[model samples]
Target: MRPMPRPAEYGQWDELPDVPEVPTSRMGDLAVLDVRERLIRLIDRRRSEDARIAELEQQWRERGGVGESPYEVSRQWVRRQTTEGALMLAGILDRLLRS
Candidate 1:
C-alpha cells in the first residue's frame, strides 16, 4: 500500500502563521476608534479565510478524496472547533466594541 499522505499534502488544516504584532509605537498611538476599525477588518479577513478553507475541502471531497478515515474525521472536527472558537471570540470583541 502507498504511504498515507501528509496533512499539508491533503489540504488538511495546518497551524497558521502568527500574525505580526502591532509595533509598540503604533499601539500606543492608536485611538479607540482606530482599534475598533482594525478589529472589524481582522474579523472580516478571518471570515474570508474560513470560507476559502471550506471551499478547498469541498473540492477535495468532490474529487473522491478519503474523508471518512478516522484521522480525517478528527482533523475536520478540530478545524470546525477552531473556527467556531475564533468566531466566538470575534463576537465577544464586537460586542465589547459596541458597548
Candidate 2:
C-alpha cells in the first residue's frame, strides 16, 4: 500500500481551535452515562465469573467429587451468585442515582 498523505498545515496543537466549554448540567448527564456503562460492565463481569465458578465446579465433579451432580450443584451455585450480584448492583445503582 502507498503511504498515507498528511495535511501540510497540521503541525501545531497551539493553532488548534479552542474546545468549547461543556455546561455543568451536561457534565452531570455524562456522569449518568458513565454510571450506566460501569453497571453494565460490572454485570457482565459477574456473569463471566459465575460461569467460571460453574466450570470449576464441573471440573471438580469430574475429578470424583462427592456430591450431587455437577449440573445440579453448579446451577444452584450460579443462581446464588446471580442473586447476590443483582442485589449489589441494585445498591450501587441506587447510590449512583442519589448522587
Instruction: List per-prediction Cα lDDT, in the order shown.
Output: 0.51, 0.51
Best candidate, TM-score? 2
- lDDT tens digits by residue: candidate 2, 44-78: 65468667867887798879898655454444444
C-alpha lDDT of candidate 1 relative to the true structure: 0.51
Q: Cα miss at 80, model 1 (Å)?
A: 11
Candidate 1, position 53, lDDT: 62
Off by over 4 Å in 2: 1-28, 68-99
- Candidate 2 backbone overlaps, count: 0
| Candidate 2 TM-score to native | 0.45
Q: What lDDT is reached at residue 32 by model 1?
A: 37
Predicted structure with the largest lDDT when compared to the true one? 2
